[model samples]
Target: MASLELRNVNKRYGQGQADTLKNINLSIDSGEFLILVGPSGCGKSTLMNCIAGLENISGGEILVEDQPISGMSPKDRDIAMVFQSYALYPTMSVRDNIAFGLKMRKVPQARIDEEVERVAKLLQIEHLLHRKPSQLSGGQQQRVAMGRALARRPKIYLFDEPLSNLDAKLRVEMRTEIKLMHQRLKTTTVYVTHDQIEAMTLGDKVAVMKDGIIQQFATPQEIYNSPANLFVASFIGSPPMNFIPLRLQRQGARWVAVLDSGQDRYELPLSVEDGQSLEGREVILGIRPEQITAANEGGPALRAEVQVVEPTGPDTLVFVSLNEVKVCCRLAPDAAPRAGESLALQFDPDRVLLFDANTGERLSKAPEHIPAGQSGNIAQFAAR
Candidate 1:
C-alpha cells in the first residue's frame, strides 16, 4: 500500500497554449480509494495518464509514499493500470495473461504460477483460467484484466473507466466486485470515471473536475451535502439538484426566497445570517427533488399543477413549473399525482442551498451534519 500526492501539477501541450491541467493538487492516503470524476473533456483521463507516467507534467511533482516519481518511467513507477478496453492478449489463456507481467520481470516460472493462482482465486476466476479472452464474458474478461494488474501487486493501482464498456447490470455487478476487492487488498487506488454513481459509491475521496480544474475534492458525503461550487453540486447527484432563480426577499427580521408557480406562491424561509449581503439579490436556490415533498407539516408549501409524472420504481418523479423553470419533486410512487392534477408541495428549509448568481460559487454555508445512516436523502444536494 502507498500514499499518492500531486503538488502544483501543471500540464500543457505547447508554448502559449492553454494548460491541459492547471495547478492540480491532491493527496491520497495509503490504502484509500480515490476517484477522479467529471464530464467528458474535463481532463480526468489526462490527469490519470499524467499520474501513470504516460504523460509528463509541465511543472510540479508526482509522489508515491512521499518519494518524487515525476521523472520515473511507467515501468519504474510501481503502478499497475487497468485500461478501459480490458487489454488482454487474444491468444493467451487467462492463466498466461495473468502471469505475463511477472514473467516480463523474470520472476521464476514457479513463482509466476503461484502468483497467477493467487489472483485468479482472489478474483474468483479459477474456473476460467484456461479459457482465452474470446471465450469469457465481458465481466469475466474484466476480471482477468484486473487479475493482471493485481499480480504485479504494485504500490498503487489505476483503473480508467474499467466498467464503462459493460452492460448496465454487469456494470453494477462489477462495481460491487471492485469495491469488495479494494476492501480485501487495501491497496492505494486511483480511479477515473465519468459516472457519478461510481464516484459516489467507490471513493474515499472524490475530485470533481471541470475544464482541467478540480471543482471540488472531498468525501462523497461532503461533496453531496456541501459542494464547493455550483458545478460540483449539479454534477454529483442522481436525479440532479433542482435550481430555481430567485430574488431574495426580506420579511422584516428574516430572509426568504420567493417561489412562484403561477398558480400559487411560496416564501421559503432562508437560514442566512448574512442577509444584508443577499437581500433582494438574484441568487439561485438549489433544492433536491427529494426535499420537495407532498405538503404535510405546512412549513413552506406551494400549489402547482403536475406537468409530468415519471415512475422510476423506487420513487416517482413529479415535475411542475415553478419560477418559470421546470422543477422535479421526488415522491413515493403511490403518492404521485396524475398529470394536470394540483399538488401541494413542501420544502425543507434547512436543506436548501444558495449559489451566487454570477460566479456560480456556493453562497450558503454547509448545514450541520447528521450522523451517517440517519438521513437517507442525497437530495439534500449540496446543503453544506
Candidate 2:
C-alpha cells in the first residue's frame, strides 16, 4: 500500500487546444480507496493515465509516499491498472494471462502459482483458469484482468470503469466482490466511473471531475448533500437535484422565493445570508426530491399542480412545475397523489440550497458543514 499525491497537475494535448487536466490537486492515504467520476471527455481517464505513467503530465508533480514519480516509466511506478478493455492476450489461457505480469517481474515459479491461485479464488475465476481469453465470457475476462493486477502486490491499483462492460446483475455482484476484496487487502486504489451509484457506494473518497478539473473531492455523502456548486449538486444525485429558478423578494424581514404554479404563488423562506445578497435579485433554489414530503405532518407548505407520478418500486416520484422548471418530489409509495391533482409539499429550509442561476455557483457563503465521515479524510492529501 502507498499514499499518492497530485499537486497542481496540468495536462494539455497541444498548445492551441484546451488543457485536459487543470491545476489538479488531490491525495489519498495508503489503503484508502479514491474514486474519480465525471462525464466523458472531462479528462478523468487522462488523469488516471498520468498517475500510471501511461501519459505524462505537462506541469506539476505526482508523488507516491512523498517520492516524486513524475518522470518514472509505467513499469517503474509500482502500480497496477485494470483497463475498461480486458486487454488479455487472445492466445493465452486465463491462468497464463494472469501469470504473465509476475513472470516478467521474475517472481519464483512457486510464488507465481500461489499468487495466481490467490487472486483467482478471490475473483472467483479459479474454474476458468485453463480457458483461453476467446473461450471466456466478458465478465470472466474482466475477472482475469483483475486477477492479473491482484497477482502483484503493487503500491497502488487503478481501475478505470472495469465493470462498465458487464450486465447490470453481474456488475452489482462484482461491485460487492470488489468491496469485499478491498476490505481484505486494504490496498490503496483509484477508480474512475461515470455511474453515480458506484461513486456513492464505493470509495473512501470521491472526486467529482468535469472539464478536466476536480470540482469537488469529498466523501459520498458530502458530494450528495453539500455539493460545492450547482454542477456538483446536479451531477452526484439520481433524478438530479431540483433546480427552481425564481426571483427572491423580501416578505417582512425574511427573504422568500416566490413559487408560481400558474394559479397561486407560495413563498419559501431563504437563508438570512442568502436573502441579504438577493434583496430583489433572481437565484435558483436547489432541493433534492427526497427533501420534499407531504405537508400533512406540518411544515412550510407550497401547493403545486402534479404533472406526473412515476413509481420506482421503492418510492414514487411526483413531478410538478415551479417557475417553468420541472421539480421532482420523492414521496412515499402509498402517499402518491394522482396527476393533475394539487398537493402541498413541505420543504426543510435548512436543506434548501441556493445557487446563482447565471454562474451556477452557490450563492450562500455559508461554509459547508460536512457531516462526520462525509470526506473520509480526502483533505489529508494536502497534508501529504
Candidate 3:
C-alpha cells in the first residue's frame, strides 16, 4: 500500500474558462480510507478521474509514496478502480473476470487460480465463481467487480459510488461487507459518493467538497460536530443543522441570543466574549435537531407550540417555531406531543454554535460564561 497526495492540483477544461478544481491539496496515509463527497456537478467525479489518470490534471502533482505519478498512465499507476456500473463483462464467469488482470500481466495460470479463490472467499462469493455476470444479481456483480480489483493487490483502490445502483437493503449489507473487507485488507482507498451516510461511515477521513474545492477534510466525528462552514454543516448531517436568525446582545461580559416564541422571549447565553462588536449584528444560531429536546426541570427551556410531529420509528421529530424560523427537535417517540400542544424545549448551550449571517463562517471561540442561578458547566434559563 502507498500513501496518496494531491498538491496544488488544478483542472481546467479550456484556456479561457474557469478552473474546475482550484489548488486542491490533500494527503492520506497508507491504508487509510478517504471519502470524497459533495452534491452533483461538484467535480467529485472529475477529481476521481484525475487521480485514476483517466483525465489528466492541468497542473500540480499527484504522488504515491512521495513519488510523482501525475505523468504516469493509469495502467502503470498500480491502482485499481471499481465503477458504479459494476462494469463486469457479460460473457465472462466470475472466476475468469477476477483472473483477467492477472492474465494480462502474464501471471501463471496456477497462481491466477489461487488468487481468484482467495478473492472469492474474501468477498464470500466462492459459490458464484462459475456464474456469468448476466446470471448474477446487482450485488453479486458488484462483488465480482471488487474481486477483480482485490485479485490485483494494487497499491490503491478507487471506488466511485459502487453501491448506488443496489437496492436499499442490499446497499446497507454491501456497505458493511465493504467496511469489513477494508479492515481485513487494509488497502489504501479513495471513494467518491454523494451519500452522506456512506461518506461518514466508510471513510477513515472525509473530504467534503463543493464547487471543486474541499470545504473540510477531517474525521467523521469532527466533520459532524465541528464543521468549518455553514455549507459543510448543512451538507453532512441527516436532518441537517437548524439555523435560527437572531441578533447578538451584550449581557455583561458575555453575549446572549434572544429567541421570541411570539409570547415570551428567552435569553440564550453564548460563550463568545466580544459581544459589544456583534451587538445589533445579525447571526445564525446552529444546533442539531438531536441537540434540542423536551425541557427538563432546572435547565434552559423555550416555550413553543408544537407545529408538527413525525415518528420515524427510532426517534420522533417535532417541529416548532422560534424567532419566526421553523425548527426541528429530535425527541423520544413517547415524549412528542400533538400539534397545537405547548411544549417547553431545552438546548445544550455548551453545544450550541454561532455563525456569521453574512459570510456563513463560524465565529471565533471565546470563553464561556455560566448564567445566573446555573452551575459553571451548565446554563439554565427557561421561557414560558
- Which numbered prediction scores highest in TM-score against the true structure? 1
Prediction 3 TM-score vs. true: 0.93
Give per-residue CA lDDT, model 2, range 1-384, as digits (tens).
999999999999878998888888889999999999988888999999999999999999999999999999999998999999989999999999999989999999999999999988888898999999999888898889989998998999999999999999999998988888899999999999999889898889999888887878887887787776777888988999999887788877778777887766777776646425576567888999998887875656888899999999899999998888888999999999999998988877778888877777666434454455544323332222
Residue 199 of model 2, lDDT score: 87
CA shift of 8, model 3, Å:
0.8
Candidate closest to the true structure, highest lDDT:
1
User: lDDT (CA) for every model shown?
Assistant: 0.88, 0.86, 0.87
Look at candidate 3 and tell me the lDDT of residue 285: 95
Q: How many residue pairs clash in each candidate?
A: 1, 0, 0
**Runs in model 3 with CA error above 4 Å?**
273-276, 367-384
Worst 10 residues of 3 by lDDT: 375-384
Candidate 1: tens digits of C-alpha lDDT, residues 185-225: 89899999999999999999998888888888788998898
Judge candidate 3 at residue 28 and give its lDDT: 94
Per-model TM values vs. the true structure: 0.94, 0.93, 0.93
Model 1: weakest 10-residue lDDT segment is 375-384
